[model samples]
Structures are given as structure tokens and as C-alpha cells.
Target: MDDDEVLLRGRVYGTDDGAPDSRPLPGRSYRELVGGPLDGLLLDVTGWDAGQLSGGAALMTELGRYGGGGRAHYGPRAGDPRCWDWAGDTP
Candidate 1:
């Protein structure tokens, strides 16, 4: 509800199972995925550590590189600190 918080469209997933009603609080926030197959998806950073956040994770998506259910690889964008960028997809 703050001026800085912008509600985005799409599905949100986290380690806790349920998605937050809105953008989470600071350290327990979510990162939006931009470009590629997983665009618009929110990745929960609620309990992610430095390594997990930095190394990134392979997320499952129906729209894969080969056109089927597979994992989409996303990592922190070089200059875009607000969201993660799609690297590629895998089976």
C-alpha cells in the first residue's frame, strides 16, 4: 500500500507454500522475473540466504526451452537490482 510498492500480475511462489497478499517486507521480499519464458513470475526471497540469492535457482515452468514442462534458470541481472533475468531453460 506504500507509494514505493507496485503490485504486479502473475503467480507468486515461495518456500513457505502460500503467497503473500502483497510485496513482502524488506528482507522477506520477492523478486520479479523479467523476459524469457518465466516473465511475470514472482520468486519469493523470504528465507533465501546470500548463496541462494546469488547463485539463483532453477524454477519449473510449463513453457520450457524445448516447449514442455522444464526448469527455467534465472539469475540476478547485472544492473537491474530489483528483479531477476532469465538465463535459459532446462529439462
Candidate 2:
């Protein structure tokens, strides 16, 4: 089995003590999300394809203004390859 597809249960960030560390694990890479509710959060982009990295993704967040569940839309920041700019949010 591919470990990449396996889910290792763990604590949710910001909700538990010592449950998980925020730092990226060895060999993992991330992109910084700027602005919006998920500002400052590092998005794990490990194993992403070229298209995925360029197009970005709508990330789920609990801190959305609408309610407890929503997705924050983001796209690659212009001229910033390692950063994503928040476009908007959706419920």
C-alpha cells in the first residue's frame, strides 16, 4: 500500500496540545497562504503536479466568516511562486 494515501489519525491543529506540530515534516513542502481567514497558514503542496501548483486549490477552513464550515479559494500569487493569494470564500 502507498503510505501517501493512508490517513494517519492525529490531533487537529490549534485544538490540542502536543497533538501535532505545525512545522512541515522532513521531505514535505508547503506554500504560504496570504490574506483571508487562512492567512499565515502553510498549505502542504507536496507531490503536487505542475497544474495543481499553478492553479491552486480551494482550502477548507473553520474560521470562515460565514460559519463553521467553508472553503477559502486561493490562487498562485502573481510573481510569487511559493505563495497563494486569497480570492474569496464559499459555503
All candidates: TM-score: 0.68, 0.74
Q: Lowest summed lDDT over 10 consecutive residues: which window, candidate 2?
A: 4-13
Clashes (backbone N, CA, C under 3 Å), per candidate, total 0, 0
What are the lDDT figures for the candidates, one per model? 0.68, 0.69
Please, what are the lDDT tens digits per residue for candidate 1 over residues 1-91?
Answer: 3321233344564322244544345555677888766677678777788888888778876566866668888899888755898898888
TM-score of 1: 0.68
For model 1, the superposed segments whose C-alpha errors exceed 4 Å read 1-8, 14-27
The segments of candidate 2 whose C-alpha lies over 4 angstroms from its true place after superposition are 1-17
Per-residue CA lDDT of candidate 2, range 1-91, in tens?
2342122222222333343555555787678777777676677788999999989888777767665678888899889878888999999
Per-model RMSD to reference: 6.5, 9.7
Candidate with best TM-score: 2
